[model samples]
Target: MPDAENTLLLVDDRPDNLFVLRMVLAEYLPDCRLITANSAEEGLTLAGRQRFDGALIDMQMSRMDGIEMCRRLKQEAGTAIIPVILMTAHHAPADLRARGLEAGADDFIERPIDNVELVARIRTMLRIKHAEDRLRAGNSELERQVAKQTAMFREYWKAVENSRDPFAIIDRGHRYSLVNDAWLKLYAIERTEVLGRPVAEVHGDEYFDAQIRLSLDSCLTGESVQYEQSFSRNGERPQQLQARLMPIAGEGGGIDGVVITLRDVTREREIERMKDEFISIAAHELNTPLAVIQGYAELLRDEPWTAPYKRTQRQEFLSLILEKCARLQKIVDDLLDLSRVDSGWMLVLHKSRWRVRDELDRQVWQFQRETLKHRFEVACDLSCGEVSADRGKIGQVIENLLGNAVKYSPRGGLIRVQAEVEGNVLRVTVADQGIGMTPEQAGRAFEKFYRADTLDTAIGGLGLGLAISRSIIEAHGGWIWLESEVGKGTRAHFTLPLMPAGTEVAIPNEMSDLKIAGEEKP
Candidate 1:
């Protein structure tokens, strides 16, 4: 009896022969299932309909012989692998046996068949067929696994290539095994020039020896290492880069290589520096006014009523206290405005018709009273008219510009204020012959917490003035900028669109429609 279930096909022209063959197979191999066909045509049809592990066919038939049937089965893709045994008559010709083998028969059997010999041949053929089937299945599974792994590798490479940060995979020999698109772009090199090349050769021996080699060695020793480095390319500004090195484990569970990733952190570092500077400056600015106010208030409190000129002294002390309080209020207001801007809150406008010349005159007159060293020149075209805008915000912007001009110019010179109506826009200019800024400083003058003057300079106030002024002007659908040259002078200019008469003003909530322009240099 067979160990596994088997299906076999039997074909003969005579019914008695088929009956005898079936009885013998059923008696010897009870585990096998046998299907009989009376003719070769019937056998071929049965083979087409289902699968058979092996087939036994009578060599002599009425129309189609066993040899011809065997050839046809071998020719078909579906039945080609089914082992065929041809049953020949006793004392069959040698040429006939040769022809049977040529027609793709697996083995032969004699007509005066010994029952045991017949059974043995069929069992052998079935076992071979079963082995071939298992091998074929194994090959198919291997192919599937290979295809799946290939797809996974492709997806991994695609993700690495599309990343913005630079990534590289180095082999155990310290040679470049893989580099993503960003890595190539960072070095401005080609893929062919990088792969299989030594790290020291590509990144320069000094750089590799000083910074990368030790870190890579540590990573290959199964330790993840991270470090920061600065690099300058093509005479450009140096970039602060943070590098992370991770160990790549091999099949044997040992560290094989290192995966390197680099991220640029220049802007983040600069922002941290600015934040630290702003905190220090804010503390000093707020402390100065508080000290002055405290001193004056104490003086007024301790003064005697009987002392001569006590009334005059008390009035002067009160005025000094009031002035310091005003200074404290301005600093608080500027800080509050900055918070509002950063939080994406709109600077609300109280829109009313107000003359540009009148606002300019008021700001100039106020500044002139505070300083006698600088002279003012005012020029306004008669055509310059009233604009619908927030009066307090506009006046604040004018004060900031005038204040900057006076503070920057220690050696006072002529300050000029001009106003004109250009088509539908009201243009205002404030030019000062003070110590100005370089092109780089002027360009970033409007940036929050950015000041041209260093901490050592005698200048005061937070750098929020220009930034807040820009926001206020932009909220009214206006543009503001500065033009300056180092050691010469600076000119500040701004334009506001004139609202048509009888038009309703719609204030924005997000300031999304504001058209803010960049700074300029002359």
Candidate 2:
């Protein structure tokens, strides 16, 4: 006997029929087990006792036919997958094969089974069973993978919705497939309306659409793009927003869509603008005072004798030259202070207690002598005796306001300086009946180097006064604002705290350098 243990069953009612088939099978498969039973019930009972690799059942059995036995085996879940071959005599009805197949028979062998044909049929059915086993295992694995991926995607979507930053994913066709709460809120769009909608169409405006379209195309090509976009819609204040588009990978490692992120960066933009203005100041604004000093110095140095000027005239020329030099020095100091102030750092303060009145009086007296056109008034109720501040910086702020009052009141009207203690804060206001400012001008007045249009272009000062003033005040824990009417005048008001309760202020050194007396007059 050849060595093998694969079991095969044969069922037949006649002894000679079972013997003949057993001899033929043994010749071809000497090592395999071929069990034979005389009745359908006996074959079914054998099947219940052990597993069989294959079964060939005679179609016509005395008590139970091959179809009935095949049907019963197929109905049970445990044996339904076993391969069954129906064997029939030539006298069996022509339709017996078809009837056997319908009852779950896998194949048929004509009566007086050919050893060669029977062998071929048995091998074919075994191969089919093997293939079906592999297919069922593969299907199970595929289903598991699908369920795992579904769970991951559900968790990812929840995170996207809950995030604070604006997030969205658009497909290769640039349609919104996912959007976070921040995205919907920032765009003012409804979820039902935005999903599946084209991105450019939703943005609507030409400029924003153009920006987004370009980035979308780049992201689809697998490039990450980051940029700043300025937005101003309706009467809203202009905003600077930073945006990023990152490529999302898909099937076959190809770019599928983009995950977009946007955030507000207006304050950063302002700092950038100030840096640019600083460069402008160094490159160009320095020339104005240089030109003045050069002209007057040359006049006093070379042409004084030829002009036969009076004694007072010669002194005046020198004074003008000194003033211009001081103005140039002040420009340098203001730039340095601003660079420090705008940086996200401490505003290096030397706070000291002093009477607000004395500071304003000195600034007003100096302005009275400097300008002959504008009449200035000072009303200080020292009811708020001492305030804590960088005296030199505060003096510079007051000087700037008084200077602007005289400079823009080109028509020379009353410039009023008033200081009074309001609760814990002492309020100081400088009002000028000069050519004031438009609403837009006043709004940006405190920005670096922003000059109002109403002021004469010939006025000789860089536009750093209000910006520097605001930075100084805020650094000292105060705020400054300006109220202006187009043709009427501007009232620039600022407040400082009287020394905090129980804290003594150091006696401030009158560091009368450029931060104080030499600030650009508006």
Candidate 3:
């Protein structure tokens, strides 16, 4: 019995001959379907109509001989691949056998045929036919898979080409195989200048050897590597870049190339540094006042009750403790306000109609008494009228500006406060003869936790003052900005919209007003 089902064609002129052939095939190859025809003409007709895995035909036919039928089957494209066998008499001439061989007959069977020999020849032909069939099917499937993978590669390449991050593919020889548009733009090179060029030639040999070669080698060894590299382009500021290299596997299951992607992390790295500096400064700022309050409280607690001048000493210790507590409270409040601004919930302003000149005069007079190192002067125009704004918030902004002026101007320089009415706005300026900032520093002066002073500077304050002041002024529909030059001076300017002369507006309740310590209410 055969392992697989197959159809076999048997042809002979005599009915008894056809019967004997069918019985022999049915008994030996039980799994195969046997079809019999009485003549060579009938066999050819049946072969044209249906498929057969193997064919057996008697040589001595009256009209069409077995050799002629085999020749006809081989001549047609459809049946050319089917295996054919010819059965001959035991005493047949050698020319008859030679004729069958020339006609594409696969094997010859002699009669009286031995049943074992007939079965063996038929099995061999079937095995060859099945092998050819499998080979054709395998070729078709391989072609289909190749087409599918080609399409996928095209899609992936398109995505890489259009991506914002720089991407490139480097072959095992360290020559560029492919580079996307962003990669070309980043290096300021054309496509013709990069493709097929050695990586060392593009990025100088020194840079390649020092920074990129080690990572590329590691990636080619099937390891993914990532590192930071800083380089300037077109004489601009140095850009911090994060580069990642990953191995690309070849068809033979080994690393064939490396895929490199670079991301610009200059701004991200700057923010990280600023955050770390802010944390250290905030810790120190909070600790100093806390230590002062703790020491004064402990001194007052352990002091003898019967000591001379105990009453006056106790009052002085209490005053110092209160001052430190106030300082700590201001720090906490400023931190909370900055947090609120960052979280998108800005400060709540209690708007009221207040004279801009009066607020400026009051803040200027207060600063004059507090600081002896700097002289204070005010010039307010009579035309400066009332403005609809938050009084306490406005005062806090003024105090922050004045305090910065006094801190930065350490050599008893003049600090002038000026205000005037321009159109519908009241413009105020606080200028000081101070150790000022560079243009770059002034640009970022309003950013949260950003300070013009370096860590080594003796000046102390949380950098949140200017940032919070901007938020307060902007919330009131006003604008704030700073102008400064290194070692010369700084001028802080802010503008508030002036209320119309006869216009009346509702003022928030006194309980809802923002209260500041030592700030008088109007």
Candidate 4:
């Protein structure tokens, strides 16, 4: 590590001067390797080819003087740091010494060289060179290590940028140190747009500062956090994102940076909305009948009337109790239907086909008797059409749709039920002049237990009606939907394949006097 262990370039046009200097160096600094050059040009060549700790130059060389050679070496980067010692035979004038100093010589020694003076000056120069050499070696090693670490960092950053999930890293200063391809793709921006920018510059200042402050505080304390956020880009509706921020640590548990991952959760949140609606509807339906039963029971115990009229009062109470009990039983049935659909228990057990026209007629007759408040119109022109579906499920679908129509419609409004055949598909429609919903509400009508109207209507039924109807129709390899406009009317329409390919069709019904008016056979 000492300068003496390094190569020393000795330049002198006179062989005697080179020999004298080499001998002095050999005696005092035996470890130093000497590279001899008879001229300044040769010394420059040697300096470029080999590493030199120091250079010894003769100030009075013939072709090129030591001052000019030192200047040239300093101009060239390869030998610029090497220390130069200028030797002159003529006790150089102060102005010449000044010129030598200006030319970048580190030390000057006058020659015909007094041995003690020559040795003393060279020893001093060698000491300085030794220190510089050691420093340079240490610095070179440090720079090499830094270069290796930088390469590794670049490779890791590239891998993260190529990942599918949106990923980024932020320093304590809240500036983006890294951002990935997926992050840019999701935000519809280039990765360059975000890197090295403050968080506020990329995301809006308000949003970015709030979220970053929270994440930074948590991460600084060695904690991880996750939350949801909404962001709007351009003029589009805001998008939902689920974000997780984790702390990256360095040696001694110091906070280094934060790694953040973001995922789109809009669709998942919508599904949760549907689930919550289902729960609300189910709870309301259960509470309704229970409330009715409780009211009647309390009236029977608390209200007082003449003992002579006790018989009639008891009869009336019993009738009210039976009605509420029936409503409760119907709610329980809906729950069971939902369970069956979810558990796949209903589909595996059995399957059957029934006369389509007969089933339609039967549902209409039953609904007519049960809900006399609504006008029921049935038009089944296809008297012999048979549908290949599970008899129970098909009946449930028809019953649910019809029941919803009757329950939600105004008293004595038109409730049109029609069945017809078009090519290989059988179409059934239930149209009602009732409280219709907006397009947005209609889109979510079949979602489990959703109601656009207020809960105060006291409809006395679970919101599972349309959900169950659609499930059954879909299970039968059919498609069901509704067409509606607010305040005008709503119509539930479904289509079933004629005979399910190779299956035989059963007779529809035997009913005649079929005055099926105001309905067209498709």
The order of the candidates by lDDT, greatest first, is 1, 3, 2, 4
Candidate 2 local lDDT, 328-447, one digit each (tens): 888888777766655644455666778777788788888888778888888888486777777887898898888788888898989999988787777888999988887767877776
Q: Give TM per candidate.
A: 0.79, 0.58, 0.65, 0.58
Candidate 2 residue 37 Cα shift, in angstroms, is 38
lDDT of each: 0.86, 0.78, 0.85, 0.77
lDDT of 4 by residue, 6-115 (tens): 67889999898788888987887788788899999998888889888778898888889999999998888888888898987676899889988999999988766777
lDDT of 2 at 31: 82
Cα displacement (angstroms), candidate 1, residue 481, comes to 4.7
Put down candidate 1 lDDT per residue, 15-49, tens digits, no spaces: 99999998988898888889999999999999999
RMSD to native, candidate 3? 10.1
Give the candidate number with the greatest lDDT. Answer: 1
- Clashing pairs for model 3 are none
Better of 3 and 4 by TM-score: 3
lDDT of candidate 2 at residue 362, scale 0 to 100: 85
Worst lDDT window (10 residues) for model 1? Answer: 513-522
Candidate topping TM-score: 1
Q: RMSD of each candidate?
A: 4.8, 10.4, 10.1, 11.4
